[model samples]
Target: MTAPASSAPPLPDPAPYQGAPERHPRRPRHPLDTATDPEAVELTAPVFGPADVDALDADLTRQHSGEPLGERLTVTGRVLDRAGRPVRGQLVEIWQANASGRYAHRRDRNPAPLDPHFTGVGRCLTDGDGRYAFTTVKPGAYPLPGAGAWRPAHIHFSFFGTALTQRLVTQMYFPGDPLLPYDPVLAAVPDPAARRRLIAAYDHQLSLAGGALGYRWDVVLGGPAATWAEEGRR
Candidate 1:
């Protein structure tokens, strides 16, 4: 059976969670931020509905003749509602920096080298089983603007769910990355377990021997323990 949508609100907004007083981006300390914004709470969000995202879009490997840098990876996951049933027809889009910790975008001034073939972006829709997968190269850790600041390897994901409240934007990290504890962005998430959800577990069973390694990351929407999402209020 299809998962039933939860009436409960999603996990707390990442803005507020990571809005420590000294945060560089400076999360608003306004009293109003604690509560849900009236607009987000009231607006009638539009549903994009089911789409046919090409499998080609999901593969970041072999974008060019030579293989992309870093280890080849297969990220597979399922979309489930709080009720624990599969949420089919959901859209999941991912973008990540190249193995050298540089994004393909022009604004990224990181010293890392960008792979000519690695576009660093992909999108796909969940099947009837609510499963989605992406074939890409593992991102690299990079230094930030601040002194000694560095981000761990991670993939940014945006889930376009059935409703505005269901829509979510979050980052996925690799398992056993020693930097997880120190990364400011990931640290913003308050719940220990919720933070764990962002880390994709190593899955040898799904690995394609002599090919890309595999990892599994399940996403639960609108549940008591939902994934951390972007702050829609702003």
Candidate 2:
């Protein structure tokens, strides 16, 4: 008798997590007021906005070092909206490979230096003013799925939307990466001007005074504030 092949079940489409009150509690008050209130402190949700790239670049550039890039990288950014207002009471999660392009997970085995203290995973709850911080190292540029080429250094971030299902996933690119021109992901932006937004800018404030590079990316989440604010208003 011939054996029959078992068919795999179809994968379900990922649903947009419209964070309803059932899952997340309704805000006691407006996020802005809460953020500004001294007594009513709140954590801001993570949002990637245009200004974030510049802020991140400045932070990293100011803290460069002659030391060998380690497996541990610190990814830090602020959660804000289009209007430049801080959104409080949110969670930020970041994941990236080591300086040698090796992941801590079991599936990765490139043997890059791994920092026991740095698992490439960092989480921070924004302060009452939508500020957040993470202590990681600068990740290394690793090979990609393409013709065995490597991609520029980057860090992945995810946001909690802070209200309803308004989560977002995005990445931050390093400054002056030659691979940016050939990178497929960065190229997807179509418009060169727009694509540049993904690249961080050099800011002196982010520097550690006597360090190699430290990042300070502040991301704006979701569509322009008008739309997202409406959702918040809902």
Clash pairs for candidate 1: none
Per-candidate local distance difference test: 0.79, 0.56
Task: Quote the positional error of residue 205 for candidate 1 in Å.
Answer: 1.0
Tell me the tens digit of each residue's lDDT in model 1 across 28-52.
Answer: 5433332556655334555454455
What residue runs in model 2 are displaced by over 4 Å at the alpha carbon? 1-75, 109-117, 209-212, 224-234
Best by TM-score: 1
In model 1, the runs with Cα more than 4 Å from the true position are: 1-52, 163-166, 208-210
